[model samples]
Target chain A: MSRLDDALREALRREEPPEGFAGRVMARIEARKERAGAWDGLMAAWRGPRLRWAGALAGAVLLIGTAAYQETQRAEGEQAKRQVMLALRITGAKLDLARARIQRVGYGLGDR
Target chain B: MRIAIVVLAATLGTAWAQDIKMPPAFDKLAAKAEESVDVTLDSGMLQLGGKFLSDKDADEAKAKKLIGGLKGIYVRSFEFAKEGEYSAADVDALRSQLQPPVWSRVVGVTSKKGGEITEVYFKTSNGAQIGGLVVIDAEPKELTVVSISGAISPEDLADLGGQFGIPKVELPKSKGKEAK
Candidate 1:
């Protein structure tokens, strides 16, 4: 542990680069940056004009689909309500007719 | 999903042990008719409709009350392009479904003016309460059949009259008097 500490302190001491050492180090850094693969280079590329528009279109489609789906459900509910009303209307009309007949029968039976 | 919930409620809440299924023979008539309306609202549909019915709306309230104890409502109506598109055999087939001891035709009105015939049948359980009713309105160019299965009565039906496009009913004098 003492040896490691001594090495770290020695390395940490103020140091000056040899004659063109700074230039060499910078050149190495530039070369390493160039070696970064095409995938990484493409990833860092500027977003194209159509990319944002495509994202917006996809978002719009998703929104419309959600709205349409909900609208369809609502429409179905409304249609169900309409059918119920129609069914009741028919029922009421028919029942009224039958009731009228029964009434006539009743009056006849009573007079008899 | 919402429909599923109502359907489930119908299965549990309504007293109907079984929903009256429409006969397959009726399918053949659908293709021949110019316009057909086939509505089958089981206990679930009724119960679901009952939920949206407002006491403030007289027709809805009346319909709601009328269907409260109902198990199902089935209506099959067809309008043909011409007369005699259907025959008595078809009528007899439907009438046969109403066999004896259960359904009795309380009224059959034949109108010469419109060449229309309307037959009404009722299923009586006790002496007073009617359990179900069927209506068949046959016109020269149209046919309408309605079946209501549930615990019902003439008075219960009378309750729906005077509104909802149902003409003012002239209830029987003696019995109507007692009913009120």
Candidate 2:
């Protein structure tokens, strides 16, 4: 029984801790906090200017694409307008010539 | 079978009455010409071009109004470096397509001295109304064929003769400048 009591005393006895144990624990906690802070900064950087740059790039591409389409349409429309004008000019010229000849014939003028 | 035949006949008859096909000889002439102007504008292209024509300009406005109901306009003008590059047979091929029963020669002017022949043919639709017009202007060194298909009136023809850069042709006052 006494042996048992002595073993209990030895097991439950309060003893002084080794030197710098609390400092080591505090240092470990500080290192963990620094690592967490650095990770948060990296995430914040990704969310800030990097996301904005991606959005801006997408918007620029859309704007350029729309402008190019409008330019193509304008060019084609202008070409068609030119063709129509040229056709009208040729038709008008020929018709005028025919009318002139008809008038000359009506006036008893021979084909000169 | 009878109904199908009737439908096909009607469609073909309508097409034949409205459009004049330029002969393949014109393509050969185009290849040989020094300078050629070939303009073919269908209904869709005309509509697109008409949208761009400004309402403010006088000529553009007139042109836009003129082409409002037009189905197509095809013009082929070829100018050779010299005379005799094209033969009379080429012109005959075009004239053959504009025969009677659907087409009638409205005006024909031939100048032997200047070696110029101009003929205008009108295609009739519904017996009286003009459905299309074709103009063949064959000069010594130039050949121009203008075919406009649509509902065109005599007033429209007069407008074409008067405006759109067609100088009001005045009778020669004792051979002054030969009417340009």
Name the candidate that leads on TM-score.
2
Q: Which regions of candidate 1 are displaced past 4 Å? A: A1-74, A97-112, B1-21, B111-115, B126-128, B172-180
Q: What is the lDDT of candidate 1?
A: 0.72
lDDT of 2 by residue, A2-91 (tens): 999999999999987899989999999999999989988998999899999989989999999999998898988999999988898889
Per-residue lDDT tens digits for candidate 1, residues B69-151, read 78888999889999988887787777866644566777677667767777877775665777787888888998889888888
DockQ of each: 0.20, 0.30
TM-score, chain A, per candidate? 0.49, 0.56
TM-score for all models, in order of appearance: 0.60, 0.75
Question: Candidate 2: where is the Cα deviation over 4 Å?
Answer: A1-40, A107-112, B1-18, B127-129, B170-180
Report, for every candidate in turn, its global Cα lDDT versus the true structure.
Answer: 0.72, 0.84
The clash count of every prediction, one per candidate, is 0, 0
